[model samples]
Target: MRNTVLDMTRLATMDAEHANRLLHQVRAAILAGRRPPVAPRPVIDASWQRMLRLGFDPDGRTSSELLQPDELEHRRRATVIGEVMRTLSGGLTEIADASLQIMVVTDPQGRVLWREGNAGVMRRANGICLEEGAAWTEDTTGTNAIGTALAARRPVQVHSAEHFVHTLHNWTCAAAPVHDPRDGRLLGIVDVSGPASSFHPATLALVNSVARLAEAELRERHRRTVERLRSVAAPILCRLTGRALAVDPHGWTAAVTGMAPVDRLPLPKTFGAGRVWLPSLGMCTVEPLPGGWLVSPEESGPPEAANRVVLDLSRPRRWTVAVSGAAGSWTQELSPRHAELLYVLAKYPQGRSAAELAADVFGDPTRTVTVRAEMSRVRRYLAGVLAHRPYRFSEEVRVEVLRPSHPSDLLPHSSAPAVVGERQMPGQDVSAERRRS
Candidate 1:
């Protein structure tokens, strides 16, 4: 299926009113349970199905509860996105103004954080409840570029009548999700919105590019922060008495002494200056550094409290592996490659050899060397709950897999032989709570 439903290329060449009318007919047919004249793009179709299941009223009012004024200001000040607001505005605001559109930036939860651009369109946006603090998630506002891009975790363009909400049919939007480059956490969305006449297929590309630029800025900022932390850690580690390392809040290692350096330390979420047990390090004393933590490992037997491991592959963009035991619990967000490997291990708790894992993950048994290297890295942090003889979780560890609410969302970006097969599984929702992904 094409990435866009309405083919803005064709629509750009057609009369605006006529193109809108044609898509209106298609949407009307879809809502009436008849086949659309042209099937909506796959993303739109999935979103419409989700809306139908949600029992949304296409004709209902498009308002969302606006965040209180103070709350709005609080969110604006609390995120790094605020630091780069000038970059976002400077990059898109002029173009949006020239094109009769408004630029919008939303938090990860889809609440409007900041918006600027064409003055007239900004007023029109207010009429549709697109003002600061209004929610624009899929469930709240129907199929829209901002909401759909959040769900899809990718750039999207929603043209006139392609919107599931009838009131939004006169408007058009393009959006792309911005993620924190340091850890790949979604920061929010950047969008361009205006009247249907302002629709341009290229808007999605532009929004996507600007979103990337925003991430690049964040990455550079994080690099500088880590460098400063390294400077602070250098002299401190020199006086350390045992195997110690300095790591940023997110676990990125700044420096290490008396041990081989690893890229990260996998600290717990609630890590602070105190004695703590880690999955990788048996027991350690942590102290506060200038912008990070100083960790000193104790020479002792590792705790065996990791009785449960939950591999979560439910979200489209983020995946986590959480471990719990008497010692406490820590959650490590998995990289994409690690997520795929863990999913396969969770599915086959009995075990998988290096060759078998290679086949499952890369569809090539000869890739065992690569598989072994990855497993070596995975074991570095998960040594407490993982066994390497056959590359499986420790027999004592109970494992659970949290699949997506929708099968297609299971490792949505993975192409591994194992994950792809799971994606084709019909009606799969493996969450232990039967909750949404």
Candidate 2:
């Protein structure tokens, strides 16, 4: 007896309004991105019978075989990916079910970067279909869910006859390709699959939702990069221009109290964090500004010679304090350019490469030959001002320059250029200079 739940004649006479409502609901679910339940129908095909005779049961897989990592380093590989996915999915356990399966992340060239989902699901899915790390291009896998969606550059539902593989005729699958935001390049594909007779109209929506969630993870990573850049730029601005500046976490401008703003854009306090850069003062500011100490130049003399000022930013929004000691007093003796370089080093403190120091202090990274020439001048000036002092230039500054000892202190160091001083102060006076700045 032929068994077809979708009898054209019977379906033709069905209530038009009811069918329209069902289709409408499915579309809404797709746009809203909801996961739908699968329907159960009798599997009476010869393939099902053959599978039953051969003892194939997607639901009855043993723990060891399914969870086994194909590689010798299975535990190490599985632990990292499993923890990452679990965190990303927010304690999601549905995808860990025996019937569900893992879809490993792969490159366009079919290199696996990471795998998503549980081992049990991967094992069962592999027994009946493709397994983790399997090459799954449309040409090889034959136009099912994952491969087809990637080829089409859109989401898709491949039900029964849509699958090219004869063995896949008993399965229904939905898939969507995830893309990177920086270049809108394809990253990977996510798919949901199950027995053909258990197809759900909302499966397409589920696949799309999963893909979107993955994209959000990339957005967070970009935010972190921006934060690091702003952090590196802020103190340099304050030191060089003798201004108080800040960049908030959301990349917003806290203030440019002593520095001038450059390249103004429509800064919205409500939208993304505002980015403020003061070129003349050599200060860059970033949103929700952190409460900390702001180092500025004392107001009593020339901007170049002004004493060091430490403002307590712990309570009120902004206030200034006069810096004490010979090192703090020596600010007047240093040139504006030298003062800026020192501030950049103090703020950055992870001694910069010649190229990086040149870019931040001189605003040129490409002028390698010219930068080296200028470094000599900078080193000469530093020696004249802090000659015989504890401060010394270093070349090996790393990204995490000064590891914070406590919340208030920063271990300052520089590698911009070496100096030879004219006058040598006594060790006590040199020690005082070191403690003052």
Candidate 3:
């Protein structure tokens, strides 16, 4: 059956007209409750099944809804993907312009954040509601490159009849997901789209390359920001006492005293100077520094028994970890890095070394420094329930991971090598929910 599907893909790629005819036949067979003469590619077949399950009609007219001006502006400002849009757009501008293609960047939610390229193509796109601020998730707009790439967590190309919506059958698109390098979170997707005739196999590779470049740029920018904060924190750290650390606005550590360096500290969503009980750091006084916050530990309290840690990664966007023990319960919204770190820790109760964690999170075992720093910060809030040497949760604590119902949705934003490998693990039901005690 798999070989049959591969043969169909080869036939479709070799002859577009035949592909269209086969698609039409498949549609007819589906309507008649019969199988088509030739099977469609597996990806396309899976998309059709998803559309059917969602009660979407293949011939139904779906309207592309655009976000209001203010809403669009807010999305642009909040998305870090905007920082790399110019670079991605610039690289593809000439090719897209010449080929009458439009380049689009969308947030992880599939909301178009930016659109550029051929003027004529842009005008045509407006007709289909593909302009800025439009939503294009598979659930909303059927199976297109932007949405499918996100759903599959990989690059994808959709041509003509592969689109579930009849109105979109004349177009082709290639898209790749762009992830935040700090923590493998999906920032958005970059897509090149045009008429079906413009479909080229190379387009998928091109978009994938551009996506890589965008991630690299994001990483470099973060590195520079950390460097700046470190410079500002050096003199301040000199005067600090006890186990203290200076961290940037997002909790990336700049410097430390009396303790090993950490990758990031879990600051509250609304951060400011005051006395707060941090999970790993215990009770501490947080003071505002030049470029970051200075946290000074005040006490090391008694340990709590029968603690519970819940790592929630079920939603499309937000992720959080909830910790409850004798100190009381506190929930912190996780940054991508923290989420990945904790997820890995939850998967391995026995504990993982810095090198192992580095390999799991960043696909580089040599990045022990980065792993150690991240673990150091993680230890702050979870100090009582977490142990070092080999980082692991305390045996006394019960851990529950709230995973997405669908494996594809499990950390939908994460593209870390380890996370990706876990997503592909067999035997897990698409609808199974397990609570590990």
Model 1 segments more than 4 A misplaced: 1-18, 302-305, 312-319, 334-341, 350-381, 384-396, 403-437
TM-score to true structure, per model: 0.85, 0.36, 0.77
lDDT by residue (tens digit), candidate 1, 1-437: 22336666887888888888878888888899997767676667767866886799999878999999999999999987888899899999999999999999999899999999999999999999999999999889999988888877778899888899999988999999888877667789999999988888888889889889999999899889999999999998898777999999888899999988998777665779889889888678899988989989887765555788888877766788898888778888887789989888877777899999999999999998899998887887787778877877887787888877878667754668898787767786557521111
lDDT per residue (tens digit) for residues 210-286 in model 3? 88998989888988988988898888788866678888777788889998776777665656798766666656789
CA shift of 398, model 3, Å: 3.1
**Lowest-lDDT window of 10 residues in candidate 3?**
427-436
Clash number for each model:
0, 18, 9
List, residue by residue over 56-76, the lDDT tens digit for candidate 2.
Answer: 432332111222345524533
The count of backbone overlaps in candidate 2 is: 18
Candidate number achieving the greatest lDDT relative to the actual structure: 1
TM-score for candidate 3: 0.77
Candidate scoring better on TM-score of 2 and 3: 3
